[model samples]
Target: MASTLRFSVTFLTLLFSLWVVEVHTSRKLISIKEEEDQTISHLLKDGEFDDPSLYMFFRINDLKYDLKSGSKLPIFFNKDDPQKLPPLITRQEADLIPFTTSKLDFLLSHFSISKDSPQGKAMKETLERCNYKPMEGQLKFCGTSLESMLDLVKETIGSNADLKVMTTKVTVPTQNTVSYALHNYTFVEAPKELFGVKMLGCHRMPYPYAVYYCHGHKSGSRVFEVNLVSDNGRQRVVGPAVCHMDTSMWNTDHVAFKVLKIEPGTAPVCHFFPLDNIVWLTK
Candidate 1:
């Protein structure tokens, strides 16, 4: 009977040890699953652009912080006059404007395409084979201008090896903050010569990307749309964006523009805009 008692005790001890091991393994599996979910959230951090085709960019549109004196102003043009001129921005005044961009640098780029790599070689090759026949009755740029633009790209883009030389961190817009600025705009039409190719209009939106202080929590919400009256009295509106520059617009009724609220499901092209700021965009 003593031997029987010893066997019973040993069996019970074994059972307890197995139970402890099972519980530890279950907890470990749960912890690993939780860690994987966190990593995914980290990779998709910050804002998500609504249209993936427009290109990824970083923007600084906060109005409170003073811009650095040496920061270069974004290129923009006035559209009200017949001459179609770009508005001038001095470095000092540009500092007060409260806007910055990384959009132009990636006009036709992908998130995976880094500036410090030779991947641009493929783009150059594609350009070489690009069908660039000028159309009838279209404004044609001089061959010299076309050649130079392509040559410049071949010489400068994607020639480097390592991209980690500079660190790129995501800029998170602050919640509930307001922004104000002069909504400058440019107008343009595609010529028959460059009908298919994507180009930033000289008088249109020189900087198509923008940001505001509100609506920072949502992934891809835009603050406002810009509008202008055509010569025929028709109103023209650019969705999710407007350019600000020409001081002449305020002086004359020739340039008609209005700020329209963007609706849900529309692609707002701006990178920054406000959410629920009890504020005004007068400037």
Candidate 2:
């Protein structure tokens, strides 16, 4: 009887060990794929967005994140390449630590948003696909992820909570290069009391736009944008496709928000927002 009992115990122990090993192996494999995809996406930020392998903007129309209340993303840059923009005045910088899934869940809760929500889930996945914070010591996100980063000089002199991104990716005409500029990404903060909790929300801006602009490309029937976050989502100017830059807030006829025009003229235009058309809501 004793020998039989010992044999049964040993058999169960072996089964449990195999199960543990299998589980660990499965997770490690998943993480490996995650790392590979994340790195490729980063490299692709400097490549053509129309590449068949990229899927960032390919599902733009299907991308339904909760932009109604505003952004829930960790504070990052408006561009992958800040050099493409005009030189900064001071060029502040800082090191950002990665926010783990648990951390994201905690922070998002303050906004009355759930990390498990449909949009929340999408953001989580997006964050995984990109390196939100730096690893080791080097800053890989400096010029690509964000144009500039604010120093964490915790001076309690301003608002208790604040986050803002006023820049966006754009294609420079004539030169035929991809770049970014301010698009009035406004952030409005209440007294931190929404649903009995603090919240900072987006206002008058599209959500993390980087892919999909339609203009006459010198190459191929279709021109791809570099650093386009998504290949599925795109914006095209209908009608005459006349473009220009107008900084005046009064100019509603302007094609883009807070941008310099590639071509200047008073040409009739019909803009299509198949992908990025988010606007600020006050109601």
Candidate 3:
């Protein structure tokens, strides 16, 4: 009977130790997973991660993390200084980052205005008049998406009495020689209605060829850049021109174009030509 009691006590102690070990392991795994998620969230908030760039960056870094099974967690070490780990950007802080000309320029510089063109003239005029404040109030009729802006523009122009606007579809070739058809708007009597509006000029750039123009208005000259490609390549940038409105308001126009390129390795490299020296947005 004494022997049996000893065995029972020993068995109980061993089971308790094993249980404690399992609990410790589980907690450690949970902590590591939380850290991994925080890291990814921070990078995304800082605009460091996106479609093509994110994929390439991850592959190049050889980052390995298993989100499933909760066994392994991805660790993010600072690329510049491996010893320091940065805190993630909070939701409130992320909201403070204005999605303005500066942000857009950093993401993509191919679709921008040249200082010499009429469109550039308009952009400069508007920027000066508004003192570079972002668009707000009743003048805040701009759309965030190209499709939404185009629809709004079509409706606005269609209701206008002085302007005769016609929306047409056109096919343009990108630098990679791929073709795409997109909606283009032509405003007849635009000069009479929009006195300062004019086709300033057009130019091209490598990887993505584009033409920009300035449309005059009471607020300022609205810059428009059209993309001339449709190959659906990896680095496709499709959006409208960025506009500076009077009263320190900045808005973008839907008159932007989409760029597509041919498949890689199949076509010869194409060089893009720069437009005449034009004013550029400053830091």
Best by lDDT: 3
Ranking by TM-score: 2, 3, 1
Best model per TM-score = 2
Q: Write the per-residue lDDT of candidate 1 for residues 34-148, one digit (tens) a residue.
A: 2232322211121232222112111223111122221111111111221232233344443343232233235335324544445444333323322233323222121112223
| Residue ranges of candidate 2 with Cα displaced over 4 Å | 1-98, 131-283
The TM-score values for the models, in the order shown, are: 0.16, 0.20, 0.19
Sorted by lDDT (best first), the order is: 3, 2, 1
Q: Single out the weakest 10-residue window by summed lDDT for candidate 1.
A: 23-32
Count of residue pairs whose backbone atoms collide, per candidate: 17, 14, 14
Q: Give candidates' CA RMSD values in order.
A: 29.0, 24.3, 27.7
- Model 2 lDDT tens row, 13-61: 5334322311110101000112332322222232223221121121111
Model 3 vs. true fold: TM: 0.19
- Model 3 regions more than 4 Å off: 1-218, 225-240, 245-283
lDDT of each: 0.23, 0.24, 0.25
Worst 10 residues of 2 by lDDT: 22-31
Model 1: residue 151 alpha-carbon error in angstroms: 18
